[model samples]
Target: MLSKVVRTIARPFDERFNLTNRLHESLLDKPVPDHARRYYFCFGGIAFFLFLTQAITGVLLTMYYVPSQDQAYSSVFYISNYVNYGWLLRSIHNWGAQLMVVFVMLHMLRVYITASYKHPREFNWVVGMLLLMTTMAFTLTGYLLPWDQKAYWGSTVTISLVEKVPFFGKSMANIIMGGDKLGQATLTRFFSAHIMVLPAGLVLFMAAHFWMVRKQGISGPL
Candidate 1:
């Protein structure tokens, strides 16, 4: 009876997607080299996991967060002090952003140190760098949502640096600021970027990164 139930659950997926054979070829039949068994080699996977965690937690946070000059700090305080387990979620989101960036950097360093970007893997290397930059942007955009002293000052300094760019500096600063200055417009733009544009970019690049890795095969030992 149990065997029959298992077969019934598997049949539709088998017919529609060739799930069994694909799984066999992609997982069981694929050889993962022994060199990849090391702890140092797993940072990319860790960063990807944290990115998923950020998506989930960020969605939950938007329920209580308000992106505005007058209310942003208040909302964050309310979440931290009043909502149940909101503090934990906020902490996870904060440290998760930092850790994700760290892991991606470590992963990139490992690849470069091992010369894993040779030949066919060079494109994946480029995609990986984009992913790292995307992670950094996520951190930067999310930093100002709290509207705290630290967030405000940090964002100001960063945007000020943007204004130092040669020909396009003022234009880029205005676009990011969403106005002549950093206020409600800036908060709204950052919020939109943190939740929408950056995640979409991450998804597309991540898909390419995985596909390239599979196609080129994982880098062998140095």
Candidate 2:
């Protein structure tokens, strides 16, 4: 019975599996192409590596972070000044985030220029766009967590900009701020969005993105 079931499942897969054989045949039966030596083929892998670094560092930083307006700045300061190598970890998390954003952008540009968005890759392109937006949202929401003058005014500017978006702009700003202005309420909201909502969304999108990549396989060099 088990053998019958195994054969049932394996038969369709065997019938459809041509690409692997074709790839092996091409590689072993013919000469390799020259342009394949370029470094650009590795950009996606590098972007993924940066994202893993960000996740690890972000998790560590969360251990010491306090989300309240009064304590947020002080907790970050303590991490920077008191904890051993905490500053280095936090700095890497911060700058690593910036670099991840840059790399993801470059990866997307590479995909677009190579026309990897065509056909079976269109959904992957959409997922990449969502990931990009989530990265920016993470940065914006995180900016408020430090609660310094820079963080305060930066968030204030962001909220003000949101309030200019059109019909529901003011309401959207209020929803994000959790009230009329930036305060404890706003801080709490941003913290929740940063640590919870955005992360959740990113994870969902990332799963879809990666699954699509595996299914469709890497785009060939143009």
Candidate 3:
């Protein structure tokens, strides 16, 4: 079964190689069209650029952050007051996250209004929806890392909403908060989810999204 699956994957690679060779032979002398003036193309690119900025700044902030209930807030304060350019890094990360979410939403809106989600691009649209959810998850998990009163109460409200789910609501909230109540375990879990798990998932989905865009080619204006 594994061999069959490997062959299935390798077949496309073989076909791609042959197609590339043929393209090199046939289109080497052709000149591509200049579409630099188009703003739609630029919008997606700008969105991706902002996401990259968020990833970089988020990593830097992680180096100094301590997620414990006792130290989390103080550590963030230390980063802000003591570490050189820490304020700038934290500010960029916070603002960049907001900007990334906005740009991603706008990019999806553009694709939707133009009917780019039709036919072959449907899966890419689905991947994009997952990306949007992941972005919001990242924001929510990170909201509690500072361990401030606002962070604590904000998370309390959010978790209460989660606990309102019908059948498995209480259990699910317990699993998420790491116990029956929010405490050190909850902070640790949120820290890991925010910094590690969600980022990894987002990267995977983003890669798939880009691969599909390349495969189907960009949708043209209607």
Candidate 2: regions farther than 4 A off: 1-37
Candidate 2 CA-lDDT value: 0.84
TM-score of 2: 0.81
> lDDT, candidate 2, residue 77?
97
TM-score of 3: 0.82
**Pairs that collide, model 3:** none
Mind giving the per-residue lDDT tens digits that candidate 2 earns over 1-222? 999998788777767986546766754565434654467666767777887787788888889999987799999999999989999998998898788788888888888888889997888888888999998998999888889999999889988999999999999999998899899999888888887898889889988997897676676777
lDDT of 1: 0.92
Error at 85, model 1, angstroms:
0.6
Per-residue C-alpha lDDT of model 1 across residues 39-107, encoded as one tens digit per residue: 988988898999999999999999999888899999999999999999999999999998998899999
Query: What is the TM-score of each predicted model, taking all chains together?
Result: 0.91, 0.81, 0.82
Candidate 1 vs 3: which has more lDDT: 1
Better of 1 and 3 by TM-score: 1
Ranking by TM-score: 1, 3, 2
Per-residue lDDT of 147 in model 2: 91
Top candidate by lDDT: 1
Order of candidate numbers by lDDT, starting with the best: 1, 3, 2
Q: TM-score for model 1? A: 0.91
